[model samples]
Target: MAAAKEGRKAPSRKSAAEEQLPGIEDARTAFAPALSGALERPRSMLRALRFRPPQLLHLEGGEAADRVALALWWAALLNCDDPEVMEPRASAMGPCLSCSSCLRLGVNMHPDLILLDGREGSIKIDDVRGLRSILGEKPHFSRWRVIIAAEAQALGIEAANSLLKVLEDPCPDTCFVFTAPQRERLLPTLVSRGWVVTLPWPEAGRPLAEELRPWEQALGRFVSEGRGWLDMTAARNGMDAAKAHQILLIGQKALADCLAGREGGMLAAVFRRMPAQALMQVDELFVECQDQLQAQVSPLLVLDSMAARLHILARR
Candidate 1:
C-alpha cells in the first residue's frame, strides 16, 4: 500500500483491480445481493444479520483479476450513494457506476478504501499495528471503511495475533476482505472467523477451474491426448517462472485426478495414452519444481529441467 499518511491522495500508479478488470462485472453480480441487503434494510439486517453478509470475507481461489475485481466491487457497492437507478435493475442492485464513490473506487482513489498487499516474505506485527491505527479513524466520506488484503497468508504469528483482537470486536463501519491462492495458506483461526467465499474460477476455466491459462490448458490437453510425441515447446516457451509454477500445479492436479479413477473423465485421453510409470515420474519432477519454487530457485531453470525430462520420456 502507499505510505501510511492521513488523508493520503491515492497514488497515480494503480493496482490492477483499480482499473476495470476482466472479472469485475462477474464479481459485482455475484455479490450484489449482499450489497443490496446492506442497503435495503440496514436497520433490520444489522440486528438480525449473522455472518452470511460477511463483515470479514476470505475470497479464496480464482485468478488475481477475479479476486481483485470482486474485492473492489464489493467495496464500491458498500460505499456508493448515487440516488440514480439503472434501467431493468438487478434483484440486488449494486453501486451506481456513475456515483462519485463508484468513480473514485473504480480507480481506487477513494479516501476511505484501503488496500494492503502483504509482502511475500511476511506481514509483520508493525504492519498490522499501522493498519489498526488507520482503522481507528472514522471514514472521511463513505459510510464504510474497506480494506482488501492480498496474500494475507503471509501475516506473521504476531501480526496474526494482533489481527485476532480486531476480528473479535470489529468496528461496525469497517469491512475486511482477504484474497489468497488457497484457503489453507491462512492460519486456521483466521480462516474460521471469516466467511470463506470461493470466487468462481476465471471464465477461462469453469467447474473444476481447469484450463486456466494457455500453458496450463495445453499441459492438460497434452496429458489427456496421450500423444507420446506431443510437442510441449509452445507451452514451455509461453510461461515465465510464475506461470510455469501454475502450469506445473495444474499438471500435478491432473495426474492426481487421473489416478483416482478420473481416467475417462477430465483427462480421459491423456490418461489412457500415457504410461502410468511415465506419468508418475513426471509427477515427481513437478513436485520437485514446486519445492524449487518455494526455495526461490530460478524459475526458468526449473521449467527447463521439467521440459528436458518430459522430452526424454516422450522419446522413450
Candidate 2:
C-alpha cells in the first residue's frame, strides 16, 4: 500500500515532456552526447577519458553534467582500491543511486566522509555542525576526507557560511564537491571558491527522435500530464521565479492525467528512465510544491518551483 501511494506521486514521461517544449528538449539535447558516451563506456577508467573537472561544474543543458559527475565518482571509487581514505563515505553516496558498492568499500563505516543532504528541506545548521565535527576528528580511514553536498543550494544563510569556512580553508586533505541544478542557488563566495565547469547544450539542429515532431510530440505529452496534476502551490522551490511559474501550471494538469490512465505503477517506470539522483530532486520539488500550496505563499512562486522541479525531472 505504501508503495502504491508512493508510486502514484511519481511523475510520468509524457507528462514531463508536456510540462514544457522546445526549452525542455533543448536541455535534453545539451548533454545527450556526453550522457551517451558515459553510459556506453562500460564501467572503466573515467579519469582516463579526458574527463574535465570544473570547480563549479554546471549541469545546465541536460542531465549530462549530472551523469558526468556520477560516472566520475564511480570510476574514481572503482579504480581507487582505497578511496575510503581519500573520499569520505559521506561524499561518496547520493540521493538517488542506491548502488551500495561504497558500502563494500568500507565507506559507509568511514568517519571521515560526511554525507550532507538537504533534499528534504534546507540543510540544517546541525547537519553542517555534524560535518564539521567529523572533519575535526583525525582521519579514520583515509588521509583526505570528502564532503558531498547533494543539495548545496538548500543551505540556509548560516549553514552556507559555516560550509564556506571549511571550503575556504579546507583541511589539508579535505575536498568538497557540491551539486546543484543551477549555480545561482549557491552564494557567490561559494561559487568563486572553486573552478567552474558548465555543461553544454546539445549541438543545434540535432536530429530528432522518430516518434513525432521531436519538439511538438514531447511538448504536448509533458504539458498535458503536468496540467492534470498541477498544484498551484510550490512556486519558490526553484532558483528562478517567472520561469518556474510557467512550468507548474503548464505541467500539473498533464502529469495527473497520465497517472489516471495508467493501469498500475506506470509512473514509476517512466521515472526510472530519468537519472536516479535527478529522481530524488524531482521528488523534493514535488514535496515543496505541496508545502507551498498549503502555506499559501505567492501562488506564482509556488508554481515556479513546481515548474523548475518538473523541468529537472524531465531532463534526461
Candidate 3:
C-alpha cells in the first residue's frame, strides 16, 4: 500500500465494544460500530481500541492495473468476520497509514504482524537471526502472524539464505506477505516456497511522462520478447530493473574472491560465516556470470538473465 497521507485525522473507537469487552464473540459485533467511528471520528481513536486478529492476503498485479483496488477489497475482509466478498473501492489504502493511525486502530502494537526492516537500509544476517530468536514463541496478541519485509530484494546473501530455512519450514501460525515490484528478482528457491500472486497495474490511464518513457518502452519489449533478464532487471529499479542485475555481478565477483582465498578481510569473513548452501549459490552465480560475459551482456543485465534461466535451471 502507498504511504498514508500526512495530517489525516485518526480513526475513532467510541463505539468499539471490543475495547469494553474483549473476546472473540464481542469482537465480531464491534466491527460495525468501530467502522462507523472510523468514518466519523479522527484516526486517533483506534489506539484506545482493543485487539484485532491478523490476516494475510497475497495479491498480484496483472497488466490491467486494478490490482491495488483488488487488494484493498480483500483488506476490508480483514476486519470483518463475514465471509462474503465485497467490491473494493480505490479510496481505501491498505494499512499504509501513518504510525498515528496504527496506534489509534489497535494495530500499532500487534505482536503477530511484525514489521521487519533493515537497520541501515540493507537487511543483514543479524536481522534473520533476530527473527529466528522469536520463531518459536506463540504470538502474544493476534491470532495469525505476519512478517512484512519492505524492499525484500535488498536482503543480503547471508540474510536471504537464513530466511530460506524459515520459509522452507515455517511455524504453523506464521504467514509471510512480501511485496516487490518484480518477483522474478527474488531468489528462485525463496519464490518457489510461497504462493506467488501478482498485482495488476492500476486500471486508470497514466500519463506518459518523459522520464518514464524509456522504462515503459523497455519493460514493454522485455515482456513481449520474453527477455527475462532484461525485464527483471528493469523492473527492480522501479523503472528499468537493471540495478539488481548489476548488483548480482558484484556478488559474482565477491564469490570468486572467496573461492580463490584472496584473503580480503570481507571475503575471508564471508567464507568463514556463510553456510554451505549459500556458498554453493554464490559459486553458481560465478558460472552464470561467465555465461553472461560470453554473451556480452552487461553486469547490470546479468541478474535478470540469471533469474529467468533459473526457472528452468533451478529445477535441476
| Candidate 3 TM-score, true structure as reference | 0.39
What is each predicted model's overall lDDT from 0 to 1? 0.58, 0.43, 0.42
Candidate 2 lDDT over residue span 54-135, tens digit each: 2232222333245344423532242233323223333422222122223312232234445565444456677878775565
Superposed by TM-score, candidate 3 places the C-alpha of residue 258 at a distance from the truth, in angstroms, of: 40
| Ranked by lDDT, top first | 1, 2, 3
TM-score of 2: 0.44
Best by TM-score: 1
Model 1 gets an lDDT of 0.58
Ranked by TM-score from best down, the candidates are 1, 2, 3
lDDT, candidate 1, at 18:
43
- Please tell me which model should have the higher lDDT, number 1 or number 3: 1
lDDT of 1 at 307: 55
Task: Give the CA lDDT, 0 to 100, for residue 62 in model 1.
Answer: 63
- Give the alpha carbon lDDT tens digit for every residue of 122-213 in model 1: 45678777877777676777666888776675565677788888788756567888877677767788888877776544442223444554
Query: Of models 1 and 2, which has the larger TM-score?
Result: 1
